[model samples]
Target: MFDKYLIDVATLRNTGPADAPTGFAFEAKLGYYRGLGLSMIEKLDVSIDGEQLPREAVRFDEGNGPLSLDEMETAYDRRWPFGTPATILIERPGGFPPGEHELSLLQQLRVSYLPFPSTNSDAKSVSFPG
Candidate 1:
């Protein structure tokens, strides 16, 4: 139900030092109705224009500072509140060039009542900031 808002287009931009960006990022809202802790995130895969980024090249931050995918595994204290957008950053050395490209996010989250983790994903064509 919250898939449409998974990625906020306005927040998509290059990140890191202004003079030499190390990556690109966008704000991503949880697709679930309720919030979940960072530890409950079982999977988070990112791809741009059909090319999947390496597992170690992604990081997540919901205002608690940036954490690598591995660090998020034990971040039980960090909670991703409902309706709040987290920044999903990708390390691309110089960030993506300015233009329209397909950005995709796939996430698997463990929930209390469900026997299996819930999977949510969304993709959209967005223009990268110059």
Candidate 2:
């Protein structure tokens, strides 16, 4: 099965005093059956302003076991701890220009006994006035 996830740009942080990179973050929820021992098996695909961005996957253990199903929320906000939002650097190829941008997340999962089930939220787009 396949699933699609969208990130909200409003939640991204862009203002701060320290030099930091600009990027978006968000939480993903996964549900699994008992003894399936299924886990997230890949990194997230990130895209900004219609362009693909390089991203590092940060995984957190929610403590839910193989027999349990629950929802997990992750931070999807982007910000620069030291520099202005405009000056913040992005590791992805050809960073976005000063204007409206759209960010998205894509991932694949593995299940032991059952077919993978997937779902997605609506895509979100935001504008940054130059």
Q: How large is the C-alpha RMSD of every model relative to the true structure?
A: 1.3, 11.3
Cα miss at 130, model 2 (Å)?
8.2
Candidate achieving the largest lDDT: 1
Which candidate achieves the best TM-score against the true structure?
1
lDDT (10s digit) by residue, model 2, range 1-130: 1123234354444432224423323333332222222233333345565655544323222233111112112222221121111111233222233576675555343434437643233345757542
Pairs in steric clash, model 1: none
Off by over 4 Å in 2: 1-6, 15-39, 55-97, 115-122
- Which segments of candidate 1 are over 4 A away from where they belong? none
TM-score of each: 0.93, 0.43
- Worst 10-residue lDDT window for candidate 2 reads 79-88
